[model samples]
Target: MIQRLNVNTEVLSTYIRNSNTPIEYLRQKLPNIDKFLKGELEPTFNQVYALSKLINIPTGLLLLKEPISASSLNVDFRTFNSELLSDISSELKDTIIEMQEKQEFLKEIVENECPFVGIFTFDDDYSDVILKAKELLGNEITRKRFDNYRKILGQLGIFIFLNGKYKDNTHRPLNLNEFRGFVLSDKKAPIIFINQLDSKTGQFFTLIHEFVHLLYGDSDLFDGEDSKKRSKTEAIINSITAEILVPKELISDMFDNQIDIRTSLDSLSRKFEVSKFVILRRLYDLSMLSRKDFMSLQNELEAEFKLIENIKKNSGGGNYHNNLLFRMDSNFFNHVNNAVQQNKITYTDAFGIVGVGYKGYKILSRGG
Candidate 1:
């Protein structure tokens, strides 16, 4: 005689919607899940727990009388191309939840010392915002590359995260069409999450774009091109971001130095240390390049990108520890390690948040 509990089907339904978990996946992960979901049959405790894990929700939450909706830490940023996002993938939603969980834990321990956060608004002139942020960043954005900017952001007490999969679950890779980056602004533990699956250049541009969201003290989910369409707030932040990456006067000056449009683009790319995509975007935005030509140039670049990806794919994935370290910001990782040392959080807690075991965590602690 097996005992089972009548879990709240309504709660389960709400969670499934929030998670975007596929019905087929649930069916495959749990036999007779349909009956459990339909309340036709009570779920065994084990079944309920398994279902909870499958949906990436806490097992106990299934018993709640009403479901508390997750914020997803983002406003519903709509665009003309909203049709493209018929649904946010479960994997991406899960990734956001994981990041928010880490932030929730870290906020209690982190210092709310960064002064640049929540300092700007869309009403302010974009140029003024760029001027102020650059004054503080002071050449970090100029001489700095991606990794350098990452460290600087960490120093500013922002949580930086980049991963192609959900919670290191390789089975669930993020979709770039859904979002290129996300940011949730906070006085303490502000978060910047980039989709590592995007082209290295794409990620770079997205980084600054999300930083703008952080500065405005707002939350955003940014998808390149799609996000640039019609949102007024997005437009202001993007305008600021363009200036931060490649100042109008500077790009204009640099543009005059080259001969052939194609040849000069490469030269400008090297000069600015930004991606050709970014250079083209800046040029197009400034009315320096035509959209048709820009699209043509971008297609050529995309073809080159595909070739590079295949070559890299043929090679093995890089060292696990290095990848893990790359995915988690040193700024955030150090706090976790320090918390362990201060006995504020157990190694177990650190390990869980960092998605590492004892050996991997030790390597991270040693600054690997």
Candidate 2:
């Protein structure tokens, strides 16, 4: 049987007319819609179905009284994958404590500063940037203290999120394991994510180092070793990250002309409360020690670490980093606590999400 059908092409016509885009641009990219206009495509519902899949748009919105601009809304799809963390075993899970700390640090940033829109508009002069932050924060935040690290991040719009547990075998990506921090970017909100499992001193340095990248509006993911390499831009930021942590002026006065790298390394390490290896790395950046000397010292530190590991194995409480997972999940606990306090979630539910029992929850809920 052959039948003739009359269609009301009004819905499609009205949408196309109201769109701000030019007819040609719409016609070329949106061929499905163009087909509908040409009367070549059958069943107008097919137009609606195809547009939704192609543009990640909703079908219902397209049928509205006023045609919507699909470009107005933006979604960020940045993903962080670290080959460095692939070998980490499941037993080394991240904890709630660390997660909370990371999140709290980020939440403070979101609340205090505007979202970092992009890296292209970042400031390059490191000294000026830190000086500005220092001036604004005053004594409440200083270069030497760990708290100052948190304050600096708060000033940036990066909100840190820590997930997984300490003994649960969770770790950062293998490639990024050396890197302490990373940044997220989209057309709208830009965020920085710092891996909290690194020691406080390491984390502090990474925070500042990554801040340097953000200032320059760099979009590449970086790790620790890359930061050590000297480039005109990186050199400036490295100096600032190091000097802000341990003022260069203070280092000059402390070392004098002794030229004893080991003694100076110890002195600076003790003074700044940073690891000897970190102090040495900074000193190398300052050109205080030759490359050969720095390598020698690094080897010594590695030996010492190996010896310590051996001792810990024999003495019990093996070399595994205790409280690692707990430290990572510090933020998760805060969320769970809020949920519990608001009566929106039960302790059982909280424990379930965290993969802990009520007993563990009781200890965690007390707050770090």
TM-score of each: 0.73, 0.51
lDDT agreement with native, every candidate: 0.71, 0.48
Off by over 4 Å in 1: 1-86, 140-144, 221-230, 310-313
- Writing each residue's lDDT as its tens digit, candidate 2 over 1-368 gives 21111223454565555554466765576765666656566333234434433444333344333343433322111112121321222222122222322332233223234433333333445566667544533534234665555545544444343322242333522222334455443222234555554546655665655555555555342222342232444556556666666666666667644657777777778777677877888777777778998899899987985686467446632222334333324444565577578765466545544545665566666645
Query: Count of backbone clashes for each model?
Result: 0, 48
Alpha carbon lDDT at 219, candidate 1: 67
Question: Which candidate number has the best TM-score?
Answer: 1
After superposing candidate 2 on the true structure, give the runs of residues whose Cα lies further than 4 Å from its correct spot: 1-123, 133-144, 151-200, 210-239, 309-332, 343-349, 352-357
Model 1, total clashes = 0
Error of 1 at 96 (Å): 0.5
